[model samples]
Target: MIPDLSHDRIDRLRDAFRAAGYDADGVVELLGPEAHVALGRGEPVPALRATTDAGPLGTLVRLFLLGQAEPQAAVEAALAPLPLTDAQAAGIVVADGDRLRAGLDVRPHGVGDDSWWVVSDLDSDLRGGRPVEPDHVLGVGHASLSLVRATSRRPVGSVLDLGTGCGVQALHASTHAQRITATDVSKRALALAEATFRLNEIDVELTEGEWFDPVRGRRFDMVVCNPPFVVGPPRTDFTYRDSGLAGDDASALVVRQLPAFLNEGGTGQLLASWVHREGEDWEDRVSRWLPPGAGVDAWFVQRDVADPALYVGTWLRDAGYDLRSPQGVQKAGEWLDWFEDNGVVGIGFGFVTLRRTDAARGEVVCEDLRHAFDDPLGPESDQWLRRVDWLRANASAEGLLAARLVTADSTVLEQVSEPGDEGWSPLVHRLHRTDGPGWQHEVDELGVRLLAGCRGALPLGELLELLAMGFGEDAEELTRAAVPVVRELVRHGMLVPAEWAGGAQ
Candidate 1:
């Protein structure tokens, strides 16, 4: 049953949740650290045992997280202002012979200091440990969190939350965007999202359609999507994960159409999966999704790549299909057969950020960055796009060497040496990044010297000249050798142009 969104009832429900401490911290405290961690992993026994007592917070956790029925009196005690009858009327809970059980999963979600309660359909773990429904509305999951962490949080006049299942991204965007528009193809998901917004006391324009169909001819300053980009043969079992498009076409469609919906200088951030064919380069395949004259700069980070079997098993298990079971085996065979027929070598999953820039030629950068990053990659993403633009604009050796450069603050030099019979000599030099995507670049001695000398005091050419004289090498030869390395450093954001560093004219 979908939640009812009466304003007064939602207000009381919010007050009740607050008064009962039904939030992230409250849940953690109620279930000790061990149980809290266990619950996150879908092992609910510890949490169930911990919350056996009929305290308000305990009762709330049992009813929602554990999918257990609580006595009507206990529920009333937990949410006094919002009566049990009102909860039933709102479809949040169902009456079961003097007891009430949650009709949906409603739990507190926290982002930093701000807290919100998200409501969605019960997941398989909370629903008698079975597979999810066909049209399930998912709560916050890993992909959703990835999109949130990757999204740029700079203030924008408008934002479009595409495929906003349960409205988590839209809720986050409300903090930074002036006007928020959330769209989804599933009406049930939309209803859950609407309830989420009302419970959180936020206003968002809701639309119904696939992709950008609802917002045709309109543009937004920012577009955030955690779309249904799962790659597989068409299936009707899941709406939240599978788009029913053949292979990776759903993701391709989204990428192909995104540029038209973004306003000039607008950013479109998405979590997507693309197919890797047997003979084609994955980078080239993904880059081909962007039209030649789209005027959009793309930065794609391939975080995970799975072969056919692994990908099939992962999604099947995610949908709660046990591979050992007969039905699970049959479905897996079907998926593998589809991949074989389609010549799918692997499936790459990643985040794609597109910025509508004014450049006449579009740039697409695809990198395999399967590494951990510090939280809140928004600023880092913005800076990276700027750096890519700068690199593209100054692609020539002359232009690059003429610009004053400085080593990025996030970089540190590390010299690795091997002990030998004669003496210790540096074998490899590494530029380690302490923050912002955490890149480690192996550099030569000359590159190290140039980076060390680039304190924003001189143009790169002059620095190379000084280094050549110090080493008794030809200046022209040194410049020729260092130009490509400098360009590479600039592309990776290890070196910043002086204008970007704000240290020189």
Candidate 2:
């Protein structure tokens, strides 16, 4: 079950900690049970002085949890070359060109297995989310892997993960494709990913560059990116969230180049944000992001949109900036200027699924998918793969037509019970219904049983036969029932008849 959460409590606690004086580099020592007890009992923590200051330190913690980039260890590593201030437990370490270190060490510092974290000290800098440090946020965790599967149909030859922050998508892509490449701007972020790869024992090629600079002319079977899509100016101390680009053009530039970098039969899946201007529709603005005549099949999912002012303030708070503060006011002003100058009133955030035409085949699909994505309706890709393998073994339509079939438990045998009858009536021809209570024949214990045995292989028919031989049933009737499921699977392209190489099919 998902955790019951209260962003409200988080907000109050964040403010309290900053009022208590904390730095943003993952320090949360001030937020022990004592702090919670005060809030729980409506008692105030005496340690935190009442102040009008917006807590930049506490806000940094919030941004990290939201998966923004941060140099978790750079300030510490540069310690000898820079001056240090007491922050959290050990102290705050910072590096400006003139200097290199200022931070809060919430506890006694220690290192584990070549990894660095301020241990023994409290973690006030972590915001409220301690375990979910931003440097290691990307992974095959629940949402990241779900993203990998939903992005496209698989068995791809190669895939590329651009702005591959935590290397989460790239790691998962290894299971679906032969080769994978991941690129990012920060070496610290890349280092965390490298550690992740070492821990998981998954091999992936890693490179460093801004956007597509390092990957000049490379093409891939797929491209995946979770770009910096926040459409606002950075807090005085900027890290991963702000890429210093105006409006949504940062995301736009990366997507525009996809056609040139996509191999034949490749798809680019991007989790991005775009800006919407007052005079034009948001959809048209994004539709224009695609290069002219590139003919890429694009599916954009708009989950959230916020007006410029609100968007700016939200990010400011995220980075622990107080809009009323002098620096905060200036930063917010700059964002408003950029937004208005670009004719952008609101910012649109969504995912972009692009399937580039197989240029080698001279095919092109230039259009938009206004239809909803992420809602699973059709047969899954694995089910489709099974159908393909079945066809490879039995090429002719006659072979499949004459085959005996058996049913499985997951194979529901739907039949109307007559008023006086006990068991359900078996169904024959395929029936169509929107809710899909299609006719199901009698299920064989063996057919339903064999699914566990076949792993993920074999289409419905081949598995049915194993059941037929295991338990005697009329082969033809079972085959008849199986045929419709197969065809339906084929119609949905979950299964294809033995055929084309390339995109010909």
Candidate 3:
């Protein structure tokens, strides 16, 4: 049942939570370090034992976080101004004789300095430690954190959070956007999001519809979505992950439809999973999702790829299915069979960033970087898009030679040598980027000297000429050989235009 979120009740509830100090630090202090760590691993026994003392904070934690029934007097004491009857009326708790049990999961979620509480359906870990319900509304999870960290948080006039399950993304967007709209296909999810916003005292416009249907004619400066991009056969049960659409279609639809909803210079970021077909490259398959000549720029980073068996097992375990059980094995085999029949070679999971630009044609940059990186990649992502645009504008050899370049502060040049009979001779030269997704590229000796000479004061052509004189080679020939490598460096942010060294270009 959805909570009745009246203004007065919300105010009282906030006061109650604040009075009890039911926040991230407070919970950790009450549960201690071991219980907190155990809870993170989905083991709630330690937490339950830690909260056995019927204190106000402990009572609330047991009722909500541990999904345990607490005595009526304890619940009433925990929420002093907000009565237990009001909690029942709001559908957040149910009366179990002399005890009260939470109807939903409410927990403290904090990022940086911003802290707030999230409300959603009880997960499998809290509810008997088994598979979750079909229409479960997820609270804060890794996917939610990934989208939050991946999104570019530049201050914008308007922002949209699509498929906002419990409004975690919208909550984060509220920190930067002036006007925020959060939409979901499920009314229940929307209700929980409303409760979340009310708890946080944030004003976000809530809409209910599938994908872009809620805001058909409006455009936003930023649109962030963590939709149901999981690829598989039709499954109507899992609303949070399965979209019922056949095989990666949901992710494709989101990518294809982003251009129309974005304002010029606006950005759309999302987390998606795409299939790797046998005959086509995964990058090529994802690049085709952007329309030709749409004036949008796209950057896709594949973070993880898995075979069919691993993919099936991973998601099954996510849903709390024990893989060694008979039912779990049967379900896993069926999913694997489905993948085999559908010609799915592998599944790639990653972040996709699309920006509407003023260019005459669209540009797509696709890369497979299956590793982890530092969080809050917004600034880096925005810089990457600008770098790509700069490279595209200066693609020719003459244009590059005429442009002033600088080695990015995050770049490092490494020379690797092998010890042989003839002594240590350079075998490989690599340029590595320590920021964003952390890319590495192998370069030749000439390439290394050229990049080293890019100190933002000299034009690239002049640097190449000096290098040619030092090596007794033809300047024109060296420039021709180095142009493509320089372009690649610029595109990957190992090199940057002098104009963009300090500010936006």
lDDT ranking of the models: 3, 1, 2
Clashes of each: 0, 38, 0
Clashing pairs in 1: none
The better-scoring model by lDDT among 2 and 3 is 3
Model 1 misplacement above 4 A: 1-3, 49-54, 95-98, 392-396, 499-505
How does each model score on lDDT?
A: 0.87, 0.50, 0.87
Local lDDT at 483 for model 1: 83
Where does the lowest 10-residue lDDT sum fall in candidate 2? Answer: 113-122
lDDT of 2 by residue, 151-235 (tens): 6546888888887766667665666788888888876556545544543446788898888887888898888877766665433
Roughly what TM-score does model 3 have, to 2 decimal places? 0.94
Tell me the deviation in Å of residue 342 in model 2: 3.3
TM-score of each: 0.94, 0.48, 0.94
RMSD of each: 2.3, 13.9, 2.2
Estimate, for each residue in 191-308, the C-alpha lDDT of model 3 and write its tens digit: 8899899999899999999889999999999999999988888765578998989889899999999878999999999999999888889988899888676999999988889988
Judged by whole-model lDDT over C-alpha atoms, candidate 3 comes out at: 0.87
Q: Using lDDT as the measure, name the better of candidate 1 and candidate 2.
A: 1
